[model samples]
Target: SNNDYNYTVDLSDKSLILISINYTVSETLEIPSTYLGRQVKNLSSSIFVTTDTSNVKTLILPDSLTTLDNTNIKPIYTLENLVIGNGITEIPDSFANYMNNLENVKLGNNVTKIGKNAFCGCARLKEIKVSDSVKYIDDYAFIGCSFNKVLIGKNVEYIGDEAFGYFDYILSNKGNSNILNPYYVINGYSSTAAEKYAKENGIKFIDLNNQPADTEQTYTYINDLVAGDINLDNKVDVNDVTLLQNYSACNVEFNDFQYKNSAVTHYITSITINNVTEIQRYLSGYIDTLEIYSVG
Candidate 1:
């Protein structure tokens, strides 16, 4: 073990496998590409499964790592940044699932497959751009997450059920789980798996080949602002709900009064797809009135 970091390893005839890291290492763990004379190729199946990983905020897998050894049994709550190296081809099942604070990820160009529930329940993730080298995305790979945009690559061939564009289950009505639909837009090529998935799930899709041009708008707030009346149309309806969804996905912007009206949860800064659900509930007679949380 001639490496600077303290980590136990198992040596094979040609490569080295990382067993476990000493708890005293830095928060940013950049696994060594080589140890002594052998390529560091693998991590133990139970790597990061312990409570010792509470301090690791940033993790960078080495370029020599070609495979994972069943390490996705649990989530690393503290990990805020991740970088998958170029040699890895598959993202393992439940990789980084439920990581509450994870904000960024850099997937390698060699990655071809994303396994089931790979990034599920990561609410803070604002956007993700899948690389063109990826071809398969397994079920629930990115479900239970909210984002402004998801850019699927053109080469993706198969996308599993609820793999993208769905948010977490926020309400349970009469013993039935009510999952909130995503407000983000999915960007991909026409006639590809991205388009197919977006159509099947009723998510907004933008074709990169035939994208619409951006237009400038002069937004003005009405004197008497009504809650959920996003367009200042004097009445709340499904169109306001659509506008709120678009605003959450970055497809549209809102003026100050419109932003105040969009706050259904009583907190303007906490607006999310759940706010969309509130509007839907009000429209369906499930709720009597929309709560006005931000009254200026």
Candidate 2:
């Protein structure tokens, strides 16, 4: 670690291991993905074991990071911010447990598992999100937390004992089950584990797919009368011929909006394509149309 540098890293095989940090570092620390011309990949458990928290607060990991210890967040008790990169695959056991100062967190997109006791005893943990890739939440994962809202992704299939429990009675009064309410309004896909847990345990639930599906639009096939309109420009020209020749004869595609707009342009500019489910030949009356105007 250099005296002039605020962050410290150990590189091996082109991957990064966040070794440590200087006590005098600023409040927010952003770890870089590249160091000494190599890619950074991992952050060990001991990176923040000895750092001072007087001024240190936010920690932002790089998107290239694939391995990290979720439980060994930091020894900084006063810190309040953390950001997980999308490269992370899981949240290990006892992650950030008892870290009452941590107010918010957004789990990475690749995270597939939430281990046991991951966020237990975090009294101030109000905002949290589980990615759509997550498949399971282990037992006691969020015990004693204060998050008021949560979203369970569609892939989640299991909810372990007391995974989101806060009190003993919240789960069950007659059965041995520890299926406590999540204490939050849960939004997830209908008939999923998320919906089942919310319903069986009397927690609030919102179906993710309850909203109407996108409206399907259809377009009419208007066979153009102009020759060499391969780029869908209304008139025949050398530009169309050149474009057609370069790509082994152009197979141009245009949506309703693009075709309609380009027909009105003094000359066609930018074109956008979308939702082409079926292929129709341009040769209904195109044979006669091409003969009427020779390609330029």
Candidate 3:
């Protein structure tokens, strides 16, 4: 039987796992957070085969879920966007196999491991920001895909070979026809796996640690700002606090403009967790001003 959200569910160990959607037509599919007073925890691998999902353009998996089971998550051919919620820790192997039209994906902040061949054959996925919480990315996790820009976090302990690039097939179809993208760029910190991988694979590595030289014009731009305004919305508040926390956790990366704003603590070089604390103190009214440190 279908639940209120038209999802077929199975109750296991007092939690609900979605079996499939029973609907005939739905454009955007949002996995229900709760069903019959129990939290929905998983999506059956056969979910896509149970119903017509060709019309679904977006899929939002909520934070209440913890697992996307092993085996290929049968494709939703027309799916263009996918949002994975924060409760999930691992993405099963071959999870999104052959999703050719998939363009954008937002991974949850808590995702720790990306299983083997998890995104195999997703040729249209252009960019992905792997959260700081991810440590292990298994072999061939991103093989057979097209990714031009990837923002890997600081805590990634291991990156499986060919995870983000497959040289001969991943070419730049935009600017110069003969140019390749797999060797273009990878934005990450210095002396990390992200840099090592880029170097070994012939990709251009942009070390987040080594930002552009601060010019006279840059310092002038820095002096005219509130120190804790990491997002630069012209105010220092709780939102800046959250952005600082995310930046500290390596969940988000900042541009030069935001980086200057975040260097509020007394660091000799870069932004650190101390800045987050400083922002908190300022918000609590424990301190009056945020000292803008001169960072090189």
Best by lDDT: 1
Tens digit of lDDT per residue, candidate 3, span 105-131?
A: 899999999998888767777667887
Q: In candidate 1, which residue ranges exceed 4 Å CA deviation? A: 1-13, 49-51, 72-75, 170-182, 212-296
TM per candidate: 0.67, 0.61, 0.62
As a TM-score, model 3 comes out at 0.62
lDDT of 1: 0.72
What's model 2's lDDT at 237?
48
Worst 10 residues of 3 by lDDT: 213-222
lDDT of 2 by residue, 78-145 (tens): 66888888888887887788786887677788988888888776767665667679988987787656
Error of 3 at 268 (Å): 55
Listed per model in order, the count of residue pairs whose N, CA or C atoms clash below 3 Å is 0, 1, 0
Between candidates 1 and 3, the TM-score winner: 1
Candidate 2's TM-score:
0.61
